[model samples]
Each structure stands twice: as structure tokens, then as C-alpha cells.
Target: MTLRLSSMRKGIRRLAAVDVGTNTVRMLVVSETEEGFRPVIRMRRITGMGKALRETGAIGAPEFAASLDALRDFRKELDRLGVVEYRACGTAALRESSNREEFLAEAARAGIPVGIITAREESRLTWEGISGGGGTGDGTLLMDIGGGSTELIAGPGKRDFVSLPIGVVLLSASFPLSEPPRSWELSNLGHFLAERIEAGTDLWKRRRFRRMVGTAGTFTTLAALERRMRIYRPERIDGVRMTLAKVRRWEKRLAGMTEAARLALPGMEKGRERYIVFGVCQAVAAMERFRIEDLTISDAGLLEGILRGLCGRKGRG
Candidate 1:
């Protein structure tokens, strides 16, 4: 379905969504028309804000500087395109950083207000964006694996959401797997995640969900690789079902490959190759912990979620 802006608000306006993720800064600009909203531009820069903060417990000067530069560029683009409304939100990276207020201050100085969203809000919006108001019977299990945190929410729809703190960037930095992780390392990470899963007693054990759905780059990349797509394609990845057994197999294969070998594989995005192992491990861990046999990968996530929020607000007006 084509997502379009209502004719009532159409005047060649543009809405921008900036997602300040742990590993990358992403911006999506969409034009509103009578027909709907059309994507005009999308850009992402790998900043590794989560990695830096995970190690130091604060957003270091260098990483802060780099993030500012990226945001400045994004602000310039919005001005160039004459965007009407802009919303920027930061996730796990900013949430965990001790100096997040400083970074937000710098960002505000540059004309972009960076709001730190709670994991619960992230999960709810994600489900809303993907389901588009269609209720998931027995509820749905939603997973978003960002660089700094992986959010898992199980609910009937958007209203009853729960979030977890396990993320790929956090795990990668904490584990420090050079190539193949030793059995001890894997065991430790698994135990760590298991505890998190156990804490979600009610949600994890709910018999309501018939299936699991995942959003974010990690799942999208895995789906693309599984399908052997030469280039990233949202159409191919969205709503694609991935079985737990299949993901485990792929995770095992990646665990054995060096970073160089992974980079050489077709469909592996350049910067993403380095973190594939971490992503796979997290996915596998979630599956094993929850006993989720199958997951559907979706590319529509935070950006779409933001847009939907805007639309909902507009509708209320």
C-alpha cells in the first residue's frame, strides 16, 4: 500500500525522521501529496556511538564530534529540501551514555532536537509501524536489534508493549569476539541473555502469539543474505519468514568465518560485515530463549513508526 499524506494537508510539504541509532545515524525525508507520502531521500552514516559509549560509559569527544557533523549535514539537507516538520530520536546509545545531555545540547544548538525514547516506546511504535493498526491475534512478538540495544515486545498490538535491553552493539563490545568466539564466550552471552528473557516471565510465556516479527537492519540483512539478494531490497526482506533452525545454522556458519571472509560474501553490506556475527548471535539467542520457531523480517521500522505518529497526530487535528 502506498502511504500518502491527506489532501487536506498537502502543499508540497516534507516530513523528516532522524533515527540516531547506536551504529548509524539515519534520516528519511518524505514528501506529502494527495496520493500519499513518498520517500524523497534517505541517508545513513556509521558513527558507532554505541560502541564508544559502551566501552567508556560516556559519549567521548571524538564520537560526539562525528555525530554532530553527521547531524549538521542532515540539517542542511532538510533545509535544502524545505522540510516542514522534523523529528529526531535517539535510542540505546544515547539512553546509556552518561553525557547524553551534552550531546543533545549540541544537537539542539544545530537546530535538531534529539529526544531519547524509552525502550518500551520504541517497541510500541515499531509494532504500530509494521502492523499498520492490524491487530496481531494472540498478540505479536516484536524484536528490534539496534547497535546499542535489542528491544523485544510482546503484545496484542501497540498498546501492550514490553521492551528488553539486549542489543547487538552492546553484546559485541562486551563480548569482544575476534573471529570465532570461544565456547565459553558464547556460553556466557547466552546465559546473560537468558536472564533477561527470564525476567520477562509474563510476556515471554504468553500463549497468545502465533508468530514472531522482527525489525531493524540486523534481521533485514540476514533476510537479504538468506535470499541471496545482490543488493538490498526492502520488498524482498519485508514480511519474510525465517525459521529458528535456519537462523541458528547461519549463525554457526558465520561464527566460523573470519571478518574478512564475511566481507567477501555476496549481499553482505560493507560496514555491516564486521558485525554480522554479533547480529546472528543475538538473533539466535532470542530465538532459543523464547522458543520462537519462526520470525518475519521487516525493513519498515523506526522511520515508518515516526511517520505514522505524525500522521496520527495530524488526524487528531
Candidate 2:
């Protein structure tokens, strides 16, 4: 077999990063490149950790089993890819889970050490990922809706960010929507989200941003749905623009559909059908609260941010 000259370089490092979120576990394996880094593999498993927490107030047996299986699979991939080092970090789900320690211990047993990151650190890493891609200008607001939390970051100020405790999993569990959610139910959910966003973002409300960027699963899924993508394509979804009117339109349409109907849609992810409506509603509410007309979609999010940090550290060493 012939090897590329780049492979012969000294200190060529391959790294892995795992993001354990409220609803999903995502892992990225990347190898260094002169331009920056190239992804070897990107994988996500919907483990429903946050859903269990939201419904049962802890990590249930089923959720724990699913999460451990995902982590163990990720560990196998890391080893197979010959990753020099890897970091596995947990987010809001783990932070709020009553029995997270047991899960964390089991994750370690599976060869992945899960460290729960603060909301602030999550916001910072998210910012680093978005800004590193080099499209967002100054004062660009970023909205990242996860299963357990939503992070809003605007401007370059050190403290210009807020992480709300509300997310799609929690909202779906809290609000019992009919097959087609009633208008009043949607109204109540909107009010609930608006109040929390308003209370948490007093600083951002007083200011304005050049544009808004949306990241994480919610935004990416919305982009895919908007395009009616039969196959999920990261290259195509990234940098897509979604207007507020269109987002609201999607919210209404989705709200009116049954879970089966939503799942049957071309672009809907398998595990997200039950809660995607809430995510869309949250997006609409956030856009209205921030008075932004449209938002740009960013596929590179927290997972990419984690990989960036690992690459940087490898470079320094």
C-alpha cells in the first residue's frame, strides 16, 4: 500500500470528541490536515437521556441502557480509528439527572469518561465553533436548542450569553399536545417559552445583533425539513438561511400534524418526530423575542467545537 506524504509527517494526530446531550450522543473523529482538520467519522445516536429525565426525574433503566450502548459503540470507533486522545462531555441532561453519577461511572466502565460541562462553557464552546467557521460578524446572536437546554449567545462580550433550562424534551413532556395540538395549547407553550427567554435575556433584549445563527440538532433538522432532504447532508444544510416567517409557517404546519405524520415526512429524523414541533415552536418564539427576521443554520456546533479544542491542544503539544 502507498501512503500519502502527509501521513509521513511527524506528530500527525487523530482525535475524537464525544458530546452527550439531553437527547443524543454524538461523536466526531478527525485527523489533522494542513488546512485544518478533516473528519474521519461523524456519528449520532438518539439515546433519549433527557426524555427520561424529563418524564421520570432521573435516568431510567431503558435510557441508561441505550446511553451506555451508544457510548460503548463510540469507544469502539475511537479505538478503531486510532484516536490519540478523546474527550467526552455531558450537558444539561447529565447536570440535571438525579442519578447521573451511576451513568457516568458506567460510561467510564465503557471506556469513555463523561464530564458534565457548565452551561457557560457549553455556550463558549458553541461560540468558538460557529465563529471559527468565519461567517458570523460582530454581535451575531446564536440560538442553540438542545433537548434539555437552550443557549443564547450574542456579541463578543465575555458575559453576553444565557442558557435557558427549557428545551424540546422538557416542553414535550410538560405539555400534552393532542394529535394536532390545540391553538390554545400552542399559545400556552409560546407564552411559557417567551417568559423564560425574556427573563433570562434582559441584556440581549436591550441590544441588537447583525444576524442570528441557529445550531444544534433542532436547527439542523429544521433546515433539512425545509429543504425536504431525503438524505441528511451536512454540507448542504450548513449555511442555509431560514426566515422568521418560514420558521413560523413550519411551526404551524408541524403543530397541526400527528407524530406519525411528522415522522413520515421526508426529512424528519426517526427519534425526533415526537418533539420536533416543540423545537420549532421554541425557534419561532426565540426569533420573535430577539426581533430577528431570519437565522442562518450552522451544522458545526458543540461537537465540532469539542473537536476544535482537542485539535488545538494537540497542536500546542
Q: Which model scores highest in TM-score?
A: 2
Report lDDT (CA) for all predictions: 0.75, 0.83
lDDT of 2 at 312: 70
Cand. 1 TM to true fold = 0.88
Error of 2 at 261 (Å): 0.5
Say which candidate scores most in lDDT: 2
Q: Write the per-residue lDDT of candidate 1 for residues 1-317, one digit (tens) a residue.
A: 01222332235778888998888888878876564567777777777787767678987777788788889989997887778787899998898899999999999998888999987777777777677655555545777778877777665344465555567767777778756567777778767777765675454465545567888878888887888877666767887898888888888887777778877777677778767777777777677766778888888888878876775555311
Give TM-scores for every candidate, taking all chains together and pairing residue i with residue i: 0.88, 0.93
Position 4, candidate 1: lDDT: 23
Lowest-lDDT window of 10 residues in candidate 2? 1-10
Ten contiguous residues with the weakest lDDT in model 1: 1-10
The runs of at least 3 residues in candidate 2 whose Cα sits more than 4 Å from the true structure, single-residue gaps closed, are 1-12, 133-135, 155-157, 315-317
| Tens digits of per-residue lDDT for model 2, 70-177 | 998888877766788888899999999999999999999999999999998898888877787454676588999999999998743578789898878888888889
